[model samples]
Target: MTVRPAWLLPKGQTREDTRLAPVGTWAPDGEIRTRDGVVPGGQPFAATGVAAMQLQIGVGRAAVQGTTAQGAYPIAVDAPETLNFTDGNAQFARIDSVILRVYDGLFDESEQPLARVEIVEGEATATPTAPTLPPCSLRLWDVTVPAGASAGVGGIDWGSALADRRRYTTAVGGIIPTGWGLSFAGAYDGQYRDADGVLERWNATDATWETYRAPEPPVETITGGLSVASGWSLSSFDARRRAGVVQFLGMFARTGATLPANPNIGDTLVATLPAGWRPIVLLEALCSNGYGFGAAAVGGDGKITIRSWAGGNNVSGIEKDTNVRISAAFVQ
Candidate 1:
């Protein structure tokens, strides 16, 4: 009696394209066993959808079986089931929609990217869960572990080789491009690195991180004076007008000083102009003693010159020891 080959039989035909579609059974020992033996599951794997979920490669293509051809393993997302290993260790179980857990080298829980991403399906859905990164530090580059940050709320390590700290250049041909290093710069708040790598803060007023300055204060009042002769009360004096290197000054005085009987045309007064100031213009002058108003001027030497005047000319005697007012504009 001769026996036919398994490929020639109906039961064997199903196993013929195991490369295209591998069929296996879940063992009570939590192992996925084929007619030959058990196969191990390779991970960092990705799958999606609700019930009858499949391990997808690109988007929604069914997985083809082969040593070379990529294939997605099929599994039910609603059920609590563990895909077992050949060593009899169950990888995991009770995995439902969007609740996939990741394991590290020691088989410890590393991350749950799927579970964290489920918030995107929340009642008031927000932005989709995704990765975020900043592009610069002491330098500009794609941020990553050991370079940009280790984990959440972590600081960037500038010493890491992955960060680019040098002045960014397009090619070795000395072609410099605008905004060559950093990316998505506006997405961040607070402090950031400028194009020159200088740490700077955002100026809300100008909407830039460039140079900014506060406004200057308003112009102020400036006052100065000199001592009056003995018995002369220099009550109040003010300079209200401006000229070329000069200030217009007005003064009120109670006088007691002696005066020349017949004052000369260029008679100097007791009061002196401040340094760097000279009386160039005289507007008015008045005396309480009814003395004639005198013509006043400031010389370039800052000397107050009270010239004998035609009217109110009491310089001989009536002007002596009398109340007087003087007004003159000075120039520096």
Candidate 2:
């Protein structure tokens, strides 16, 4: 299929394309699939105002240089059942109306497109499978196993190619891309390998193997302007703002407001500019205890600017604006 590198929606809002479509907005016809009987009596799904969920790729961030480590992500929001009800007094919890907001990005080595997504469902694990994969990226039945039959959760082996880990022992509720909140990335895992990979959750005795597939996107070829097509490569970033973990994927072009202080000696560019495309919530993430850090923003248009603090402290010590040529799509 023809995959492009762009988010359908702006930050803090649902993508226009998803305004009246399924939560998995990027999924065309089929991209991934979930195991039958996996969700049990799949109660029809739907969504309306999804504006408070989180998104994240499920791959290890740790990797060698030259490529991103393999990872996984959910194109849907899997959550627990609410307003509980059932068939004829048999009140088994049921969940419905899970929505996911997705953003598209560059392709990886396997020609797979990276998708940043969010789910607002209660609780579910997003393996690299579908009812989630975009239409052009799936052929699910080709690897189907028996329904209701426990694979790794009970007794399934995912071969020896993947690292053996613990798996889940139950068929918990699954979500299909519901929610629109803060998220870390697109695609499932960061690693878009060119071959089969595996994921396992602790299942008491041993790690249960998950049934999934992968469509690795090619992350080669560094660019000049660092657009989505060029891959926004920032100069330096603040890991202090990192919520949990911090890893530098790539350097970015400088796009900050000129400062008045003399940063000639040792002024490392901490945060990155929205120069490539546009930044929604760009902030300097530090490696500290997630506190004592600072943040500021240029408008979505990115015309507003701020100079770095002399000592990297955003306190009310002293700040100065710059007289320089800046570019932004939106005005401050």
Candidate 3:
């Protein structure tokens, strides 16, 4: 028989200075964040545009249902299977770190303390690298679980594989007064370690992170390198105003600039400035996009600003009334 370990690699009791989960992930075809539902815990979470995991869709009993005996069951159950990286489309994610926290239900399963968690940092290759594996060739971590809780470190292996992307069902026969739940800090789900550590949408209509997750004791992260000259800009229609832009400047104080909402005089717009990436910024406006989603995330406050118009008058071909809302967390 295989011996089980005692300690399981649990969630970080003390939150780190830097957030791990990807922020504001965008779908390849469009600039919209995914609402694919909360991804379950203790598994490798990855996707291109949004932080949603595929659903465990069950099948209906077919003609076999009537043919099989009512009380009879298959001697061996064929579990659900995943075609590696099949759903992998535009968005790709590398784990900042995976956290697996222990849980003990609170007063009738009210609150589950993040007792223990496992953190993993690894890059996910293309969901499907062409002829190689279709879309996303995601190979989950083949973790060898220990038998005894007393044999290992919290039932987890250090310097070893833990879990995978396909599935996670109960392994050992354990029971509790109340069960537990978890939260995934996908791109939109920013604050990995705030009081609650769960994700709350800032502008649901616009698909942006909640303002609660900005410059503070709990800081968030935005990848650099999303500026214009790179190929585009984002603007709002008229409703989602409070829009703005965040730039990713290197080693510089993060910055931001908002576009005014005036569609009458000129076509309100926020152009992506061709600048360095890294330090990110946030923008708020009517929330517009190229595909007419009327919203997108491009640059942050850290980059240089290209006002809708240069020189008091509309530039050679610029419009002054373009409006874009911008935002960011500022340390006091």
Best by lDDT: 1
lDDT of 2 by residue, 198-249 (tens): 3322232332223344454433222223222121123432211122222222
- Per-prediction TM-score to the true structure, in the order listed: 0.27, 0.19, 0.16
Give the TM-score (vs. native) of candidate 2: 0.19
Which portions of model 3 show Cα errors greater than 4 Å?
1-133, 136-159, 163-196, 202-207, 211-332
Error of 1 at 253 (Å): 2.8
Model 1 C-alpha lDDT per residue in residues 219-291, reported as the tens digit of each score: 3234666656454566666654333433444454536545543644356464765654554444333333455
Cα lDDT tens digits, model 3, 208-229, are 4443544434323343333433
Candidate number that wins on TM-score, 2 or 3: 2
Worst 10 residues of 2 by lDDT: 59-68
Error of 1 at 137 (Å): 45
List of clashing residue pairs for candidate 1? 19-65, 63-72, 245-332, 246-330, 246-331, 278-331, 279-298, 292-312
Candidates arranged by TM-score, highest first: 1, 2, 3
Clashes of each: 8, 71, 91
Instruction: Report the alpha-carbon TM-score of model 3 versus the true structure.
Output: 0.16
Ten contiguous residues with the weakest lDDT in model 3 = 59-68
